[model samples]
Target: MSELKIDERCKSTLKKIILFCTVLFLVSVVGAYILARGNWELIEAQIAQMMEGVMDNLNIETNKNFGLSLFINNLRAVSLMILTGFIPFLFIPIFILVLNGIIIGALPMLTGTNFVSTMVFGILPHGIFELSAIILGASFGVMICLTIVRKIIGKNTVEFKILLKYILKKYVFVIIPLLVIAAIVEAYITPIILMNTIF
Candidate 1:
C-alpha cells in the first residue's frame, strides 16, 4: 500500500501526541519510583508477581528463544495499544503506557542495583528503539481516538478508513522494524554488555 501523506496540521498533531505520551510515560516512571521508595518491600513483591505473571503468559523457556519471544511480546503489546484506540478519550492506551512506565521505573529497586548503572547497561541498549516504537504506536492510537472523538462531536475530520490505513502503513514500515532491532539487542547484545560491565 502507498504511504499516506500527512498534512502539516496532522503532522503537528502527531508530534504533540508523541510529546504528550513521552511526558506521561516519564512522569509515571518518576512518580512510581518515588512512591515505591517509602514502601519498597511491598512494591517489590508486587512487581515481582506482576513480572512472573507476564513471563508465564509469554511462556519463554530459555535464552535460546528469548529474542523471538520478546519480539512477539512487544508486538502484541504495541498492537494492543493501537487496537484499543477505539476506547473513548484514549483511556486504555494511555493506561497501558503508564503501566509500562511504572514497571520499568521499578526495575532498579527490584534488582537491588544502582539506578543509573542498571538503566545504562541493562535497559538503554534496547530501550531506545523499543520505547520509540511503542510511543509511536501509542501516539497513532491516541490520534485515532481523538479522531473518533471529533467525529462524535460533529467536527470535520479525515475519514476513519484513511486514517487507519495511514497508521497501518506506519506500523508496517516503521514500528515493526524498530521492535525487531530492539529484540535482537535486548536478547543478545544487552546480555553480552551486561556480562562485561555490570554482571
Candidate 2:
C-alpha cells in the first residue's frame, strides 16, 4: 500500500482499538463501583493500601518538585503499558487498564466523599489528559499484540520495525506531551482546586 494509504489504515485501526480500550476501561470502572458498594470495607482497605504503596513509591513530600516527579512516574507507567504489549494476547495491558479503572472507581467510596464532586474537582482536571494518554498507549499496545497474532497467522501485516517506529513516533509526539501537561496540572492546579472546592 502507498504510504498515505498505510497511514490512513493505521489511523483507522488505532481508532477502533482506542474505542475498545475506552469501553473496557469504563466497564471496569462501573463494575468496580458496583462491587465496592456491595463490599465497601474490603474494597476500601484494598484501595487504601494500594494508594499508600503508590504514595510511598512516589515519595512526594512537597509540591516544589512534584510536577517532575509525577511526570517521571507517569512516563514509567505508560511506557510499561506499551512494553507489556510484547506479551501475546494483550493480557498485561488490559490488566493495567482495568486496575487503573478500579482504583479510580473506588476512590470516592474510599474517601467517603461526594462522588460527583470529587471526580469533577479532583480527577477530571488532570484525568482528561492523563487518561487520554493512557488509553492511547494501551491501544498501541493492543495493536502490537494484534500485529503479532496476524504475523503468526500468515496474514499481511506491517513489519514489526515499521510498527514500532510509528508507535514510538506517536508516543514521543503525542503521549509524552499529554502526560507532561497532565503532570503539571495534577501537581499544581489540581491540588489548588481540590483545596478550595472539595477538601
Candidate 3:
C-alpha cells in the first residue's frame, strides 16, 4: 500500500474508533438514565450507602492530596482500559465503557440536574478532558480489533507490535497527561466552581 492509502486507512480507523466510543457512551448514558429515572430513590440510596465510608472520612481540609489521589485512581482505570485494547476483541474494553457510560448517565438523573448552563460549567472543566481520555483510551484498546479486521481482509500490513507501540505512546504521552489535568481540575477547580454556582 502507498503512503496515501496508509494515511487514509489510519484516518478511517480513527473515525471508526471514535464512532464506537460515542455510540457506547451514548447508549450507556441513555440506558442508565432510563433505568434510574423512575427509581431514583433506590439509586440515591445505593449511592449514599456506597459513599458512607468515604463520606465519613471526607475532609475538605485534607483534600490537599486529593488531586494526586484522584489522578492515580483515574490513571489506574485508564491503564486497565488501554491494556484491554491489547486484546483483539471488543468485549472487555467495550464492557468497561458501557459500565462507565451508565454511571455517567445515571448520575445526573439520580442527582437531579437543573440549570443546564451552570451544570455544564461545573462539570465541563474536568469532564471534557476526563471523558475524552477515557473514550480515546478505549478507542486505543479497540485499535487491535481493527487491525485484526484489516489483516483478515488483507488491507493492513502493519504488525501488531508496531500498532501496539503507537497505542502505548498515545497512552503515555497523551492520555496520561489529560487525565492528570482532569484530576487537578476535578479535585480542586470543579468543586469550587460548583460550590459557587451550581451547588
Candidate 4:
C-alpha cells in the first residue's frame, strides 16, 4: 500500500512536469513567433548589439573566427541553474526555466532560412542534452522548494535540521547528476556541433 502510494505520487509528479513543459513550449513558440513577425530585423539588430556588448565585456575581439567561442562563453550567462539560485525569491528557478523555454523556442524563428541550418548545427548537438539537464535540475530545485513551502503551510513549522538534511540529500542525489550531464554536454558535444554546424 505504501509502495502504491509512492508510485501514485511519482506518477502525479511526472504528469505535472509534462504539463509544465508543454505549456512552456507552446507559450514560447507563440511568443517567439509573434515577436519575430512584428520586428525580426529589429530583434536581430538588438541581438547584434547585445553580442557586441558581451564581446566587449569579455574582451574578445569581434571576429567571425570566434563564433563557437562566443556561444560557449555566453552559455554561462543564460544558465538557468546558475542564476536562479542567486535570486531572493523561492520560485525564481521556475520562472527562469519558463523564460528560457520561451527564448529557446523562438530562437530559430528569428533567424533567416539559411541561418536555421546553422543554428541547428550550432545549438542542437549539445543543446538538446544540455538544455534537458538544465530544465531537469531547475525543476528539481523548484519542486524541492515547493515541498518546503507545503510543509511550512501544513504544520506551520519545520525543524531546521530535518529540512536542511532533506535539502542536502536532494541536492546530492538529483542536482549533482544533472550538473554532471550539463558539464559533459558543454565540454564535449557543444563545441563539435557548433563547429560542424557553423563551418
lDDT of each: 0.84, 0.85, 0.71, 0.53
Per-residue CA lDDT of candidate 2, range 93-124, in tens? 87888888988888878877776787799989
- Comparison by lDDT, 3 against 4, better one: 3
Model 1 segments beyond 4 Å from truth? 1-6
> What's the true lDDT of residue 2 in model 4?
50
Cα RMSD (angstroms) for every candidate in the order listed: 2.6, 1.4, 3.7, 6.1
Write one digit per residue (lDDT tens) for candidate 3, span 1-199.
Answer: 5555665566577778879797878778777777777787778776555445333444345466777776776776677877776566454777887877766666676456652543386557897889888888778667766677667777845566656766777788989999989988988789788778766
Give the CA lDDT, 0 to 100, for residue 48 in model 2: 89
Give the per-residue lDDT digits (tens) of candidate 1, residues 72-176: 899999999998998877557888899888888887788777667877899899999999998988888898899899999999876678778778888999999
Best by TM-score: 2
> How does candidate 2 score on lDDT?
0.85
Poorest stretch of ten by lDDT in candidate 1: 1-10
Give the backbone clash total of model 1.
Answer: 0
For model 2, the stretches where C-alpha displacement exceeds 4 angstroms are: none
Q: After superposition, how far is residue 40 of candidate 3 from its true place, in Å?
A: 2.7
lDDT assessment of candidate 1: 0.84
Candidate 3: list runs displaced more than 4 Å: 1-8, 41-61, 112-119, 148-157
Candidate 2: pairs in clash: none
TM-score of each: 0.91, 0.94, 0.78, 0.55
> How would you encode candidate 4's per-residue C-alpha lDDT over 105-158 as one tens digit per residue?
455654443435644675566556555555554554454455556665774333
